[model samples]
Target: MAFHCYLWHGDTATAQGPKRDTLCGDLSMATPPVLTRDWLRKPQSMLRRKASTPEEAVNWLGEVFDQHAEKMTHSQVTGIRRQDRFGSALTDLQAGNDLSWGFPLVGSKYLALAVIVVR
Candidate 1:
């Protein structure tokens, strides 16, 4: 499927596959070549927290994710999917916000996430 570039209204999907029957895939690129979190960080898994203000949950979350992503899943596909975005469904999972990726099928063990962003 061709990569569709839309404004970051915070309501677009990072990936949209072809018909259910469609196969082989390649996502067109965006500038700055989306970097993995590991690549984004240097010399360490965690970047020093600029601030740990508990009152600003967003701050703590940003730091936690920045560090965790630096250590875990960092695929370009995943990174680019998140590059222009701030948080991941993964974050919610860690924060006890929402842990379900969703069911692949009704009540299926697998979960799904819908992220919308662009850069």
Candidate 2:
């Protein structure tokens, strides 16, 4: 089963509503990367933290990516796929170009997040 994933960016302060900028991953995946699934299986400590600033959010996301990258390095295909979906967004965030917010999927047994970037 394929699942649709997106990385959206926008400004929330406008009356026009959230302005979306697609940084990457406007595609469907048969399943999330193995490292991602494994990380999600761990305790939700990191996910529970609140990011009050864009810098903080970026830092948090960086850690998440770091974890994935460490394991992904063992598998070329998985690393490439994961990087394709999230690398640019992380790069942009690290460069101070945008802010990130992750919305957790409600009523789901597994941890699923929809990440939105605020420009």
Candidate 3:
């Protein structure tokens, strides 16, 4: 099984993109990158991670950050009380709200690959 994530962009009500101010105001913003043929070239890489829950997704992201973005500060890396960046994202997701417009992880690369695995 593959991890399934839905990225919300534009407007669900009017079918338009989010307001510029709304996008610019939010701190933890994340938009799924456009799926490209180059990413598809290594099909197995996507399958390597198949998160079955929000917690699993957060764990996967944390592991990725630890491995790739070690230079980040302690606050950006810790998962204390589930109130960290990833934790906030999880809260938003659970409330049926789309993850706002920022990278939930520590690296710029993750912002481009913001896959939201929900089950």
Q: Pick the candidate with the highest lDDT.
A: 3
By summed lDDT, which 10 consecutive residues of candidate 1 come out lowest? 1-10
TM-score of each: 0.23, 0.29, 0.41
Please, what are the lDDT tens digits per residue for candidate 3 over residues 1-100? 2343332323222122345345423333432233322222223434335566666655665565456446445664553543466778666555544332
Q: Is candidate 1 or candidate 3 better by TM-score?
A: 3
Give a tens-digit lDDT track for model 2, residues 1-119.
11112232222221122321221121122222223323223333423344555445545555654543433325532535655545665565455443332322222212223233323
Please identify model 1 stretches exceeding 4 Å from their true place: 1-55, 76-84, 87-119
As a TM-score, model 3 comes out at 0.41
Q: Report the Cα lDDT for residue 35, model 2.
A: 32
lDDT of 1 by residue, 40-109 (tens): 1222212223322222333444444454343343462264555344455435333433111111221212
Best by TM-score: 3
Stretches of candidate 2 off by over 4 Å are 1-47, 73-119
Query: Which runs in model 3 stand beyond 4 Å of their true positions?
Result: 1-32, 35-44, 71-82, 96-111, 117-119
What does candidate 1 score on TM?
0.23
- The lDDT, on a scale of 0 to 1, for candidate 1 is 0.27
